[model samples]
Target: MTMMSLSWSLVSIANKKQQQIRRFKITIHRLFGFAFLCSISFFLFSPKIPRSPNYHQFADMRNLLGVPNTLNVITNFPFLVVGVLGLILALEGGFFTISSQAEISTWILFYAGILGVAFGSVYYHMKPDNNRVLWDTLPMMVAYSSLFSSLVVERIGQRIGLGCMCALLFAAFTCIVYERIYDDIRLCLMFQLILPLAIAAVAYMYPSNYTHSTYWFSSIGIYLLAKLEAVSDKKLYRANNYVISGHSLEHVCLALIPFLLSVMLICRERKFKRLGDLKDQL
Candidate 1:
């Protein structure tokens, strides 16, 4: 908590480590650019991955109380609750240690996307077909876009993060259009995998201005676990004696990401100045 104190740890890293950090800073942009180009090129040139023909089928299709896919449909109710509460807190302001309006705006978009997901997912589960897939998919994509953008705002800065948010939003729409025109959800799937990894990597590389960085890791871990649950839907359903489907549990698990993030916001404080900000001050 000492600002610019002559602490041994602050000025005492070996010369080789400093050299490595300097080299990393110098090549960071080019590294990201190359990775971006390679990812796009690979996806564009690769064989198209068509939406599985049986994608609409769910392990739990129980018509409970006149609702089809009842568990999956109802599980999204938590998103509604969490989304509304998070949105309100983000807008109400003064609760989080957010630095700028741009950061707040990104969070607002994040929660708004979650709210959209709640409704869209319910509608999609009602029929579970390509015809209704966009409603479910696009909202979650938007949520992922903004969630990552908000993290960027925290670690990098507001201006660049806002730009990234806009770009990601455009990409989200592109994923939908590509799916419609080419019948390939590969880009969308790739994005879902990429964003969490991006968040984890970025959070590790960038100096945060706040405490509780572990919360970011926790959220990412939960996201991966949700993906695992989704993939094991039938096994989980049978394992639990048909009480809950993995896909439904996935929804519940994903809901915890935002909840944990909200808790992080409330609990974290400005524990250190970003080194970049310090450099600028100098």
Candidate 2:
């Protein structure tokens, strides 16, 4: 072939390769999303593990009549259902894809659950008459919020959710510091170190999109912030030793995985963009 024909052939081949790589990534994301949904559903409702006595006792706060826990569960129930369904829809994007409008509609329902959790927690806390209601429901709210943001929200919505998540981490961090200063380091370490690391692990394990890296970033920031606070306060020694208060190596592992994955993802995205630019040149 002439030089010109050879060059054109190679360019066409490269473009085709980029398109195939993009499709493969999309397929992997969808399959992983479905698998993740199944695992999370199991974690939430599995019968093998014993239920927390506190969770049941809290449920019994009142009769099935307008009890807060019941009400809380019912009112916020749609989010859970939609969350599961969204994962299915996300999976369908792998096969019989829905229209973009349907996907957007599903996303709206999905993010509603996320924002509800943030707002719901504030509501739950303000009612001192129902501390049990607040405490029992808050964890679910936080969990669903994190999962919803990670799995559902898109470009703009993802950024908004990230801002909210950072606010939560900052609030948690501030509380930990204040508690450490006036009360004790124990509370701070638990809230700051343990909680962040746990969050990092959970977020890392979740099958999320490119924009959702904020969740991972926030998780790491929370840990890094806690570590800084501990060192500044001369509590690193306390954090590393002792049976109860020490920051374990396990926590370090949790933060590291997600942080490393975040780096890997950034590199991959840049590479994808470079390929797209080359395609445009053709």
Q: lDDT: which candidate is best?
A: 1
**Candidate 2 Cα RMSD after full superposition onto the native fold (Å):** 16.1
lDDT of 1 by residue, 1-282 (tens): 445552444465344445545654555577578768978897778989888858888899999999999999999999999999999999999887777798899999999999999999999999988879999999999998998888877766566678889999999999899999999888888787777777787777766668887988898889989999999999999999999999999999999998998898899888655557666766
lDDT against the true structure, per candidate, is 0.85, 0.41
For residue 101, model 2's alpha carbon misses the true position, in angstroms, by 9.0
Residue 60 displacement in candidate 2 (angstroms): 27
Q: For each candidate, what TM-score against the reference? A: 0.85, 0.28
- Steric collisions counted per model: 0, 0
> Between which residue pairs do clashes occur in model 1?
none
After superposition, candidate 1 runs with Cα above 4 Å error? 1-37, 40-45, 273-282
Candidate 2 lDDT (Cα, 0 to 1): 0.41
Q: Where does candidate 2 stray beyond 4 Å? A: 1-110, 129-199, 202-215, 223-278
